[model samples]
Target: MPKQITRAYEERLLRIRIMSHTGDKIHIKLPLDFVKRMVKNNALDFLSGKDDIMDSQKLLNLLINAFDYNLTGEIAYLERNNGDIIRLIID
Candidate 1:
């Protein structure tokens, strides 16, 4: 019999948490499609040559920029160790 391969369902959305050394944190959820689109749009500049490198912070900034432009819906929360919490929702 031939070997069979199975494909898993593609993830459509993702949630991530970022924290600073000062104990400040932010939670973000975004659609994978939005990230793909951003990467595609910037591929020319970011992926022009094999020697080019794109860091995670740069990608994070791109996502933040997309949120700023209202390109997609997002939910964000900011938490501080000093008992302060802030919530933001954008669509």
Candidate 2:
């Protein structure tokens, strides 16, 4: 049998932001459960680019582990030379 992991005391949210040099910005907030469901249903297929591929299973595992480990805060941040920014946060 596989070992079961304990869930965190509180639920978390995933926050994503995309900003363009032209002052355009997009922000998205999703509950963890919704993200897990989306990953299971392959609804995040757009995450893969022409030459880059993201494994759904791996992404699911990461999400599971995030809660298991009680991880919170910014997990990814990127800034381009053109002054655009992207950020991924677990809160």
Best-matching candidate per TM-score: 2
Per-residue lDDT for 1-91 in model 1, tens only?
9664332224334455555556778777556556556555664242133533435446456555654554533454545454545443333
Model 2 weakest 10-residue run by lDDT: 47-56
Each model's C-alpha lDDT? 0.49, 0.70
Which parts of model 1 have CA positions greater than 4 angstroms off? 1-11, 43-54, 57-91
Tens digits of per-residue lDDT for model 2 on 1-91?
A: 9764444544668887989899999999888878768877878664444543445356556666775686877776767677878687788
In model 2, how large is the Cα lDDT of residue 11? 61
Model 2 CA lDDT for position 25: 92
Number of clashes recorded per candidate: 0, 0
**Overall local distance difference test of candidate 1:** 0.49
Off by over 4 Å in 2: 1-11, 51-64, 80-83
